[model samples]
Target: MSWLALFFLGTFTGLLAGIFGLGGGFLLVPLLSALGIPVAEAAGTSLIAVWFSAIAGSSLNWLKDKFDGGKSFQIAFLGIPAAQLGVVVSNLFPDRLLKLIFAVLLLGMIYLMNLRQQLSEQETDIKLAPSPPTPGATGRKFYWWRYASIGAVSGFMSGLFGIGGGLIMVPLQLGFLAETLESAVANSLGAMVAIAASGLIGHAWRSEVLWIPGLCLGAGSIFGAPLGSYILPRLPNGLVTTAFRLLLLILSIYMVRASWASGWV
Candidate 1:
């Protein structure tokens, strides 16, 4: 294996991980496979690297007062258990068809993201025109159950797809919880630590992980994550969120291609 290339991939993915709360699977899984690693091993190793990256990025967010620990913890509380069930579900479906479905869902997410932007725009215009609802007025009661459901759904997707679950979590946080983009990212990263840890345990138990490569990736990711976190605060929220949607769209397109390649689409 080319350790240098792996390290570089880790660095690149780690940067994205920190920026988007994405575990960077859209690159890491393919890169590792290109390097001759089996897909299962690649997923396992990438998950470990993702976990560490999330740890580093979230710690920085927490220190900067950007993380919502309470919400993050609540999300994780349900996510962990659902992940186990999701792993089970992964085995139930044909991989090619499942990936196609996931791709379609990602497209739906892109649409929802745009819809969210429209709603936020309306809110912004309203705020500009007149005395909006009092600042202290409860905007919406915090729906703990909805958050848990988000965790469960995202967790299931994570386990089934062998991913970090951040893609599912981040947009939902924005749409449902009305969190700022930065805060959603910070909270998503914090919550993913638990989800990734659960995935690692399952992968390790199955002996699917490539320990040396995973370690190398994790080492590089920690260094890269802080760089991304540093850049995150400086970027426009709308730009970053648009980039996030584009990234998901690109990944979904990749999945569609993969499905066709596998003769399933």
Candidate 2:
């Protein structure tokens, strides 16, 4: 039954990965821990699910003509090193401290989602929208500072929290990188492949992962990912953005509750 539950979780994560290009760790860690898995172990195992799901999701995006390959690869190049570094750094922190930090990140995400939602509503009335690409906002072009910053921060967070940084990446791409919801999600999925793999390597080195659970999760994700990517391009941007924000909000609340229960707050 526990394995079945984990499989369901992975299925959901795979869907999110396809739709949002996130590593799906935002919800996985807390849920796993709540199911009696240790924090580090949960993170480690989650990375495995993230890696497989990301592969499937990203592949789907490519087939669906939803991805920007060059830009995505550029971000991945910068994110890879940063992700590896984050994995090393995460082990140095106490589990309780890490939970607190993760909780804080969740709060920040919720705030960002709300802000973006408001701005989006406002923009709907503007009428003339060329996406008004900022002078150097996120896009096809390589904005060194922008990509570098996102890579470093999201990668580290991905490693630290075992989140594969998709949550952070999507919003950052939209807010600062000057991406639409669609492109942000596509690029984010591309980046998660590297970020989650780096984190998984670190965890595997420490023998923190449970192969049975990881395999079960990966198996479920295999079926869910393609389905999600298939649905992504068909959804309205506003609907997709709303769903993303709501998902983050729900996950943030869950993490906050878990942190409090664990006395990490």
Give model 1's TM-score versus the native structure.
Answer: 0.77
Worst 10 contiguous positions by lDDT, candidate 2: 132-141
lDDT of 2 by residue, 124-161 (tens): 54437765435443433557557667877877777667
Say what the RMSD of model 1 is. 3.9
Q: Write the per-residue lDDT of candidate 1 for residues 5-101, one digit (tens) a residue.
A: 7677678777876675456655576566545554455566777787887787778777888878888887888888887676666556665666577
- Give Cα-based local distance difference scores for all models: 0.71, 0.73
Q: Estimated TM-score per prediction? A: 0.77, 0.78
User: Per-prediction count of colliding residue pairs?
Assistant: 0, 1
Off by over 4 Å in 1: 18-21, 33-41, 105-109, 112-142, 229-253, 263-265
